[model samples]
Target: MRFEPRRHTSDDERILPLINVVFLLLIFFMLAGTLSAMDPFEITPPRSASSGEDNPRDIVVLVGADGRLALDGTPVAEADFEAALAAQLTESEGARVRLKADGHADATHVVALMERLRAAGVTRVLLLTIRDEA
Candidate 1:
């Protein structure tokens, strides 16, 4: 009696790699989607006895405790901030700016930023904050 070796069928050979690649792609997209761009730094807004409507479409300017700044969630360099901010608001003449300032961040810096926003032609600038108990 002679021993014979069996060869893999074409169906099995082709399908295995296809299934593996599909799974890999699925996992890749799942992770990529979950790992979207996050804010460069975290901030704790001050509390206030105030309430107002917030438009989700309104632009946000996040100010960190370390004097770091981000425009619409993207970090912006102080040197080019005027140009960058102007570029962002070029279309909207009366763009509403929402300032999210960290509780511990410099008040002077926050004011300065607000001034810059005003200079950039933002007519209405709202300082975002948590509401305190009345």
Candidate 2:
């Protein structure tokens, strides 16, 4: 009977390359997303509860602290805001709306805008508020 030595396969040798490749892809995507261009406008949503899952909204209406309105990131004049919103609502019946108001935005203005949107056939509106860390 002849006795032979068995080959030993090191698990780390196969896993090290996989880990290196994963890290390289992660770094690449992080850089790519950081450099990606989006709306030039700056908006910071108000924070409150941070636990619940958020519902999807079809249209976005942003209210800047200075009383400016942006429909889906495009600026809409005060006089034209309702018209634009109505048009969007009509396009999608019973449309779900999301209002992203700046943390410093006036409460009255936000309420007024909500009333106007309700009048414009937007029955379902979600006012987005950021979750508080505390």
Candidate 3:
């Protein structure tokens, strides 16, 4: 009786393990990476020597250099800003909020924003800034 030798595995079979590993890596990255919503507009945060870090959980208020405003990543018209903010304040558990203002934003505007936040009953407002790399 003559037995035939086994044929070589196809290229597809050879690549199966690589494909599985690549898929596994993709899944791993997807699970391991943290995804967060980006700001509606670009903002260059002011520089500071403080080593404070930002907490992603905090609700953020954004102010652009050109006087644009966004709340929790959604653009809000200047006229509607207070109403929107007050609405959020009532539903929010904490009075804490984060202010992310552009580096070039006017100081008075920022202060006015803080006053507005205070008037709206926000007790703890954290100003976000980038660490100076000097």
Candidate 4:
């Protein structure tokens, strides 16, 4: 009697190529995709006294929730804010500022403030934010 040809059947043989294709797609996406940084939504940073230790001329600019502004804890009027910051910059060796904006503060206002700070010859501006504790 003649023997029929043996047929090889295995589920793994069918799936092996699919697994390789999936892994290749995964690597392709990982390499092609760009990573971006996002701002934290909820995090409180611990209080530290060393924030200004590096620079004696470092000043903190506060932006309140109600559009109020303060330079070094002294409240400043909106119209005079630029002049006040300019004056601080003139007195300091390097124009560096720490911006402490309230969570509820307007985004436009903060950006405007940053622009003003840059226009006023501020070399650097640090945005102080609390660390996420979750």
Candidate 5:
């Protein structure tokens, strides 16, 4: 008696389950992604006594200890800082600005930056700091 060879089955039956798993993983990652505007420069901000809540979409301005200034991670001259801020504010009405200054930064430097923001029509400004750990 002659024995017939068995036909190999295609993997088409397993494709649907694999596709479903991949889709679910994609959705999970999308939802789990943390959305926050982070400063490009690493700064050790001064501690604050106030328990101010942080907004995710606020524009950030960083002032380094050496008086270097950056807005949204882009370095700008002291004279051009106001113009850059104005351009940003023009895009969003009533947009809030957050200032992140190094702990060792001079107080006067921070104050001057704040004044510039005010002059540029940013009415609301928030100072960013790390909350002290108990």
Candidate 6:
């Protein structure tokens, strides 16, 4: 008596399940990733000795070395900075503003900006600084 041999399945059936699993995993990670602002300009932030703690800021103002001012990554005229800040402060009653200035930024420029923020009724302004590597 002769015995019959079993036939092997096609490659498409084996690969389809693996392809579907990989796509499912990719979709899961894409949905899980954090979505935040991608600031266009680059700035070497100053370092600070203090380890201060505060809640997340509602507005982030960036000051470039060439005296350029940006609010939430959008460029704005120096004259209009205060007005824009005032509008944001009014919308969020007690929200704080954070300032991120380049390392080479002038102290006077920062001070002047702070004064403007204060005039706009922003009492709490936190200066952002990077922690030095040990």
Which is the better candidate, 2 or 5, if ranked by TM-score? Answer: 5
Mind giving the per-residue lDDT tens digits that candidate 2 earns over 1-134? 99799978799987999999999999999998887435436778888875444444478888988888889778888999888887877776655898889989999999999999878877777888878888
Off by over 4 Å in 5: 1-38
Better structure of 5 and 6 per TM-score: 6
lDDT of 3 by residue, 1-134 (tens): 99999899999999999999999999999977857667899999999988666665667999999989999999999999999998888777765699999999999999999999888888999899999989
lDDT for each of the candidates? 0.86, 0.82, 0.90, 0.76, 0.84, 0.84
Residue 36's lDDT within candidate 6 is 65
Residue 44 shift from truth in candidate 1, angstroms: 1.2
Model 4 clash tally?
A: 3
Q: Candidate 2: lDDT of 44?
A: 88
Model 1 is weakest, by summed lDDT over 10 consecutive residues, at 87-96
| Candidate 3 local Cα displacement, residue 40, angstroms | 0.5
Q: What are the TM-scores, per candidate, against the unseen true structure?
A: 0.70, 0.66, 0.72, 0.57, 0.70, 0.73
Model 5 agreement with the true structure over 28-111: per-residue lDDT tens digits? 998778565466666889986677876757788999888888888888888888788888888777669999899999999899
Poorest 10 consecutive residues by lDDT, candidate 4: 37-46
Candidate 6 C-alpha error for residue 53, in Å: 1.9
Model 4 CA lDDT for position 62: 82
Global fold similarity of model 3 (TM-score): 0.72
Q: Which stretches of candidate 1 lie over 4 Å from their true place?
A: 1-37
Better of 3 and 5 by TM-score: 3
Q: Which pairs of residues have clashing backbones in candidate 4?
A: 44-131, 45-130, 45-131
Residue pairs of candidate 6 with colliding backbone atoms:
none
**Model 3, global lDDT:** 0.90
Q: Candidate 4: lDDT of 132? A: 51
